[model samples]
Target chain A: NAGVTQTPKFRILKIGQSMTLQCTQDMNHNYMYWYRQDPGMGLKLIYYSVGAGITDKGEVPNGYNVSRSTTEDFPLRLELAAPSQTSVYFCASSTGQGYNEQFFGPGTRLTVL
Target chain B: AQSVAQPEDQVNVAEGNPLTVKCTYSVSGNPYLFWYVQYPNRGLQFLLKYITGDNLVKGSYGFEAEFNKSQTSFHLKKPSALVSDSALYFCAVYYGQNFVFGPGTRLSVLP
Candidate 1:
């Protein structure tokens, strides 16, 4: 069902460059999230949206921004990529109720040089 | 605030042996615990979870986790380990419209 999909599986960007990580889900879920995984650091939430037109900051949202224009899509924007932003980015979605088990994407691996 | 911890950085076990990955969490409300496995270069895959009903929750791949409310621990366990079971394991707690994940534990099942 392609529960969740993320684009640009791998990308290399120089410091100060800007880019967007695209995420989409076909599960009709209302809750979407962005997270970055670093070695030994587990997953850190970047941004999240409860539904279309609603976005909120997460634990580590300083260098990133997110928007949810439609129920199926939530895109993260890096206005000024920095070396500190280098990590594997994952997009996840959930049903937004009850237990709220999330389904994740394959992840977009970005290297900020 | 809610927090989760996986005390062990890594765990090793012989194939067919019982294996356990430790995790503990802190939260003011009822804890919704979860376990996810990630293979090399892959995304975290849901393994099991504990909500409200039962303390012993069974999940995919013959894995289960016991939620100990008194200890604030939800440790993942499997009766028999397999080489394929070797991966990175994460423990998470659902709270306040967000999920907090642990630092993760690496599991190595030797044949």
Candidate 2:
């Protein structure tokens, strides 16, 4: 399996600019997640999807939105980019919750100027 | 709410020496803990997890973690450290369908 894959390995956006970070997993996982990693900080959950067409906000979901149209794809949308949103974004997928292991993507490094 | 904690911001160890990275968790019920490693400029990778069963759980790259129910801690350890073992380690706890990660601890294995 290809595990999880993310697009646009790196991106630079201006203030108020909008963009979408695409993520796909071939493992046929039922749960998908979006997280951000800042310097000197641990990964923070932004949004997650339990299954297709079912999404929920996570701990740090204020500046982001997500949609899971298919079991394999979960995309995160940034309506208005800000400097605070500049961080490395990771997409992960898991078969289920609790003890299930999460497979992570390579991550997209975003820089908002 | 469930949460994890890594007290140290950084840990230093010499090559071939035993290394330990501390992690403590707070949960109301059965604690599901996990350890992940992040290399420089890369994404986080799963190292190991503790759902239940044995207190000692072995994982990738000769790493293992001990779950101490008494202390609510799950500490990652390696018998012999290597230069390549240097990276960032994170401890996490799953609760309410979400996993909360602690502030990462940076490990530097000196050669």
Candidate 3:
């Protein structure tokens, strides 16, 4: 199985520009998550979904939005890009049973200029 | 709120020497802890997890972690370190329906 996959491995956006980051999982996971990693810092959860059509904000949900249309897809939307949003974004999925371990994607590096 | 802490920013060890990476957690109830390793330019890979049972839990790549209930610590250890073991390690705790990760500790196994 392809575990988890993300699109546009790298991207550069200008101030006020908007973009969407796509993520998909083939493992039929019930839980999906979006996180950002900054240099010398741990990952910060932006948003998460327990199932299709159900989503919630995470620790750092500001400046980001997410929609889970299908069990396999969860996309993150950035309405207005800022330099602070410049970081490596990762998508992960899990079965959400008994606090299962998460499977992470390769991640997308975003640079906002 | 649950949290994780990796006191050291970087740890250096010589090849073939025993190594340890410290992690301490703060949780109100039963603590569910985990360890993940990340190589350069790659996503995190699960190393081991402490759900319950033995205090000593073994994981992939000859790695193991010990859960100390009293100290609230889960430290990763290896009997003999190898150059390939060098990577960034993170400790995480699951609480309140979310996972809180530590700042991460970089391990440098000098050959």
* CA lDDT for candidate 1: 0.93
Error of 2 at A35 (Å): 0.3
Alpha-carbon runs more than 4 Å astray in model 2: none
lDDT scores in order:
0.93, 0.93, 0.94
Pull out the clashing pairs in model 2.
none
- Docking level for model 3: medium
Q: Tell me how far the alpha carbon of residue A56 in candidate 1 is from the true structure, in angstroms, after superposition.
A: 0.8
The digit string of per-residue lDDT tens for model 1 on A14-110 reads: 9999999999999999999999999889899999898999999989999898888999999999999999999999999989852678899999999
Query: Weakest 10 consecutive residues, lDDT, candidate 1 chain B?
Result: B92-101
Worst 10 residues of 3 chain A by lDDT: A92-101
Q: How would the candidate models be sorted by lDDT, starting from the highest?
A: 3, 2, 1
| Per-residue lDDT value at A99 in model 1 | 66
Model 3 misplacement above 4 A: none
Query: B1-111, model 2: which lDDT tens digit per residue?
Result: 777889999999999999999999889888789999988777789999988899999999999999999899999999999999999999999877888999999999998
DockQ (C-alpha based) per candidate is 0.69, 0.78, 0.70
Every candidate's CA RMSD: 1.0, 1.0, 0.9
